[model samples]
Structures are given as C-alpha cells and as structure tokens.
Target: MTTVAVFRPADERLDDAVALLESLGATPVPDPMLEVDPTGVCPREDADFAVLTSKTGAELAEAEGWDAQTTTVCAIGDPTADALRAAGYAVDVVPEEFSSGGIVSTLEGRVDGARVEVARSDHGSDVLTDGLNDAGAYVHETVLYRLTRPDGAGESADRAAAGELDAALFTSSMTVENFLAAATERGVREDALAGLNDAAVGTIGDPTRETAAAHGIDVDVVPERADFESLARATLAAAE
Candidate 1:
C-alpha cells in the first residue's frame, strides 16, 4: 500500500489532505509538523477587498466577524476561495496558482487604489502585502494565528526514518522548515529527509520548492495549482 504523509499543522487542513489521499486510493498518515493557535486577531473593516492566503487565515477572519457585504474576497487559490465562499464571503478573485507570488500576480492589475485587508499568520513573509502596496493598493495586514512546531516531532521523524511513508507533502515553506527542524531535534534529520528522495517529494509551489532545495532536498513534484487536490494528483503522477 502506498502511504502518503501530510505535514500540514492544522487539523482541518490535514483532514482535508487525508481525505484527498483516500479518494486517490493512497493511505494517508498524519505527520503534522506544526500546531496552530486559532485565536489570533486580524483587524477587519469594511474595505473594498480582502485577501485570504490560507484556510487558517480565512477562518480567523470569519471568527473576527468580518462582514463580507459587498466586499470582494480574494483567495490565493481554489481551496482558499472555497473557504471564503463557505464563510459567506463573495470570492472576487482566485489565482490559478496558490502562492503569495501567484496572488500578487493575479491582483497586479486589478487592485489599483483598492483598500484591501489581508488576514494571515503572524510570521508569514511580507511578499503579499509588499506586492499589493507596490501595486498602489492600500493594504493592511492582520495576524490571525501563530504556528508552533509539534511536540511529537521525534516520533514523526522516527516514522520517516523507518521508511513508513511513500511520500511527504509540503504545502508551504514554513511546513518544510518546521519538518526539518523537528527531524533535526530528533537527531534523524538526514535519514528522515533522505527517505523522501526514495518516494515522491511533493511541494505546493515554487516558494516551497525553494525551501526544500535550500535544505538540499530536491522537490520531485509541484502542482500547477497549489491546492491539496492538485498536489495529490501531482504526487501520483510523480510516483508513476
């Protein structure tokens, strides 16, 4: 049986990844690398637009009682766009690729002079905000959550070292960094990461691919779209 490891920290996203794996007839093993604190705050206002880069960010905005009334919600990709719609927000834009760069490119010509609020994690890069600002949008960012490495990083590393996984999926650069840090803490960083080369090493996009490459791990698969479904399909294709 082919086993896929999901490295997403959030339970909700991990569950979605596992479900996608099952639908593809692959066995999924949860190997969350980080934990999310869902109670962070992202200041929301009746802006002309809102940007959601991750499902966690979207959830945080919804929790903060962000009114979607006549406001255009732009998501990084389809999955995040789905989340925004589920939260009763009008999804105005969804990039074909799901990355900060992709979101920036999609909004380059569209957001000029627009008041846009971005909801995201505490430690995320300023690429989106900076890009929007450069494009003449009045951009405000609010941190909605924090991500910490999981406590069971050692055991997770052990599983990887034992070759129990056929592939590992990384949705973001942060996930790659946290996974490596966890493995290093367990003294099995090399072994755990080396196991990935034998199987399919999947990334969501270019940024994540760069992160994996920085650690000397080559990414074998990158989906056209940065969603779990696309990642799963790419993983299967790479495995083939």
Candidate 2:
C-alpha cells in the first residue's frame, strides 16, 4: 500500500484528510506537525468589514466572541466561508479563485473607505492588508493565533527521509514551511528534501504551490477544485 503523509495542524480537518486517503486505498499516516495556539489578538469592534483567510482564524474569532452579524464578513474560500457560517457569521463574499490575490481582485473597488478588519495567524501573508489598503480601505490586521511545530513534526520528516513515505499532502503554505523547518532542525534538510523528491507532492492551492516552489519542491498533483477530496484524488493519481 502506498503510504501518504499528512502533516497538517491537529485540528478538525485531520479526520477528513485521513478519511479521504483511506477511501482512496492509501495508508494514511496522521502525523500532525503543527499546533495552533491563540495569540489573544482581536479585531476592532467598529470595523465595517471582517476578513478571514483560514478556518483557524475563524475559529479564533468565534472563540473570542466576535459579533460577526454586525460586520460584513469575507472569506477566501469555501472552507473558511463554511467555518464563518457555522460560527453564525453570514459570509458576504468569497472570492472566486480562493486566494489572497483573489480577495484583492474580488474586492477591488468595493473596499473604498471601508474599515476592514483582517484576522489571521501570527505569520500570515500581508497580501490582503496591502491590497485592501491600496484599494482605499482602512485595514486593521490582527494576529489571532500562532503556529508551532511539535516533536512529531521532526519524526514525520525523519520517516520521509528514510523513504518510508510515498506521498505528502500539503493544504497550506505554512505546513510546507513548518515541515521543512523540522527537517532542517533534524540536520536532514537536504536528505529529507531529496527523499521527498522521489515521492508524489500534492498541494491544495496556488499559495501552497508557490511556497513549495520557493522551497524547490515540484508539485506533481493539483486538483482543479480546491477541496480535501479533490486533493486526495490528485495525490493518489500522482502516486500511481
């Protein structure tokens, strides 16, 4: 059986990833590499619009008692939109392309003079902030959480370096960065990357692809649709 490595944050998404891999006849290795902890950052209560790029940020907003109903909510994609909806926020906008650049494109002229609040991870990209600002929106960007790789991250990288893994699924750019950081910490960065080269590399979206490329990894599998099942199918196809 082909062993598929999933090194995402240990969250609600892990079960879905594991199940998707299993349904596709791949052995799922649930090696959660990262953990998300709240940084206690909160968005402004008087903002006219709120932005969410990831489900983690949405989760944080919900936990922090954000009154989403009073603010216009925008999400980058379906998953984040779904999360915001589940948390009682009516998602007003979801960019068609499901990316930060997409958000910039979608909200181009509409953000003028709007007070926008961006809630994301501690080290999130500033594309939305800059884009909204350029579009004349007053943006207040807040870091709702931080990502930290635990010891299991290094172990997962070690397994890959030992050639025990056949494929790796990356849902976000941060996962790639954290995984590589783990490999570097183990002093097997080059060897781990080399071993990964022999395995199928799967990415969920453009951000992950760009990040993987920056790290010199060629992505072999990409789904036309940005979803877990599509990614799983793409990974299986590339592995075969």
Candidate 3:
C-alpha cells in the first residue's frame, strides 16, 4: 500500500483524515503538526460584514453563540460556508475562487467604508487584511484560534527523511512550516526535504503552495478545488 503522511490538527480532523486515507487504500502516517488554541474572543457584533476562513473558525464562533447582529456573513470557500450554515449562520457570500484575494475581490466594491470582521486563526495571511484595507474596508481581526505544533510530532518527518513516505498532504502554510520545524528538530531537515522531493507533495491552496516553494519544497499536486479530500486524493493518486 502507498504510505501517505497527513498533517492535520490532533483532533477529530486528524481522525477523519486518517480514515479517508485508509478508505483510499493508503497507509496513513497521522502526524499532527497543528493544535488549536482558542483565544476566547468573539467577533464584534457591530461590524457591517464578517468573514470566516476555516471550518474550525466557524465552529468556534458558533460555540460562542456569535450573533452576527445584522452583519453579513462571508466565507472564503464552500466548506467554510457550509460550516457556517450548519452552525445556523446565514452566509451571504462565498467567493468562486476560494481564497483571501478572491474574497477581497468579491467584496471590494461593496465593503468600502464598511467595517469587516475577520475571525480565524493566528496564521491568517496579511493578504486578507491588506486587500480589504486597500479596497477601503475597515478591517478588524479577531484571532479565534492559535495553531501550534504538538510535542513529539516528528515521526512523519523522520519517515520522510528516510524516504519512507510516498506522499504528504499539507493543509496550510503553518502545517508546512511545522513539518519542516519537526525535521529541523530531528536534525534531518535537509534529508527529509530531499526525501519529500523524491515523493509527491500536495498543498490545499495557493498560499500553502507558495510557502512550500519558498522553502524549496516541490509540490506535485494542487487540486482545482481547495479542500482536504481533493488535496489528499490528488496527492495519493499522483503518488501511485
């Protein structure tokens, strides 16, 4: 069976990812590189618009019983929008492009002179706020969660360095950074990268792909759709 590495948070998300890989006939190396640390902060109810960038963010916001209070809700992608809707929030916008730039483009004209609340993880890209600002939206960011690599999480890094993984899935730029950090901690950064280069790599989105590129990692798969299942299936299929 093809051996694949997945770097989701050490939660139900990781379990679901592992199950998906197993169902696809791949041996999964479930090394979680990100852990969620909620900030106990909620989006201000006074904003004209609110944005959710991840499913986790949607869940967290709902947990807080977040009342948009007339704020139009927007999500960057379908998954996020679905998450919001499932949480009983009415989604008013979701960009066709499924990215920060895409969302900014979708709302640029309408958000001018409007207050936009951004609720997501600490690793959110500056491209989001900058573009919103450039478009004349008053943006306020509320960090719903902070992502940190779990301790003793380098098994996949070791496997990658040993040329044991057939493919690897990176969901976010932070996951890529944390994976490389794990390799560095094991003093196998260069070797691990070499091994990964010999295998297939996939990133969930363009920002993640650019991060991998900046770190000299070669990406073989970037699905037309920005979702985990698509990313994993595409990478595993490429590995085969």
lDDT top scorer? 3
Better of 1 and 2 by TM-score: 2
What is residue 78's positional error in candidate 1, in angstroms? 1.5
Clashing pairs in 1: none
Model 2, runs deviating above 4 Å: none
Clashing pairs in 2: none
**How do all models score by TM-score?**
0.90, 0.93, 0.98
Candidate 2 lDDT over residue span 8-99, tens digit each:
66676888788778878999888777788898766667888888988888888888888866788899889899988888889999988877
lDDT of each: 0.80, 0.84, 0.93
Q: Per-residue lDDT for 191-225 in model 1, tens only?
A: 98878767788998888899899997778998876
Order of the predicted models by lDDT, top scorer first: 3, 2, 1
TM-score of 1: 0.90
Global CA lDDT computed for model 2? 0.84
Q: How close is candidate 3 to the true structure, as a TM-score?
A: 0.98
